[model samples]
Target: MGGRGAEICCASIPRVWYPGMMVLVRWDMPDGLKHIVKEKMVEVEKYDETGSIYIHFFPNDEVRVVVSIYPGYSTAHPIRHYGKPENINP
Candidate 1:
């Protein structure tokens, strides 16, 4: 997800259509690069007429964890999106 700011919106979508589904891990950057996961079989939609699913995750020590969604499907892999620990604001 890298265009729309629908982080909370995407995460809130129910898993009804995606039953027994799991998130998938696409690639993880090394050498202190940010961790990026690629989710499959997810229904991504733009917010209103000027929004899209653009998600960006920060380092663990930088900000809270978040789940983002993008519009796409896996061709040769299983349909599952990645999952990360969310942070609790105190």
Candidate 2:
């Protein structure tokens, strides 16, 4: 969302059906320092909830990223309720 900021990079997974839900994220560190983390795994807690997805990054693990995409919505779509990018620690 809005030019890559300090968060980790992400890409959406298409085809696979995940119930519409908001991913919640929590890192061992705060937001700004999250980039330095290497390997990480996103423990998918629940499905269909609005919030941040918690993540723990491995020291040597490359940052794992996930981006959400709304197919019907155009790229110009406003990131409010749909199609917002999020970072997964691992």
Candidate 3:
């Protein structure tokens, strides 16, 4: 399955977690958008001090963010897990 910016099905998306470093984020799309965004890479637009991480999908440019009560924690439905390849404990 694929979406606007997606060339093929993918379970993960590359994300810049630190300067010069990239990680992958595994997520689940809302049921309504799954057909439109199947396995597409979710692009992170920015982050804020409130533990909110902003994100968007390519071509569509619709922005979403994960708000959290604790640092490094997310309460957003679109996000499932994020980490390096070898240590994705979430």
lDDT of 3 by residue, 29-51 (tens): 56764533344334343333243
Clash pairs, model 3 backbone: none
Better of 1 and 2 by TM-score: 2
Residue 76's lDDT within candidate 1 is: 19
Q: Please estimate how well model 3 matches the true structure, expressed as its whole-model Cα lDDT.
A: 0.34
Candidate 2's C-alpha runs over 4 A off are: 1-5, 13-37, 49-90
Residue-level lDDT tens digits of model 1 in 1-90: 222223233334333333343333233344456665543332332122222223344344222222223232322112123444332222
36: Cα error in model 3, Å: 6.9
Per lDDT, the best of the predicted structures is 3
Taken over the whole model, the C-alpha lDDT of each candidate is: 0.31, 0.33, 0.34
lDDT of 2 by residue, 1-90 (tens): 122224434623334436443343434434774553222334333323233222323234323223333211334211222233332222
Off by over 4 Å in 1: 1-25, 32-50, 61-90
Q: How does each model score on TM-score?
A: 0.21, 0.21, 0.23
Sort the predicted structures by lDDT, highest score first: 3, 2, 1
Q: What TM-score does model 3 achieve against the real structure?
A: 0.23
The C-alpha local distance difference test score for the whole of candidate 1 amounts to 0.31
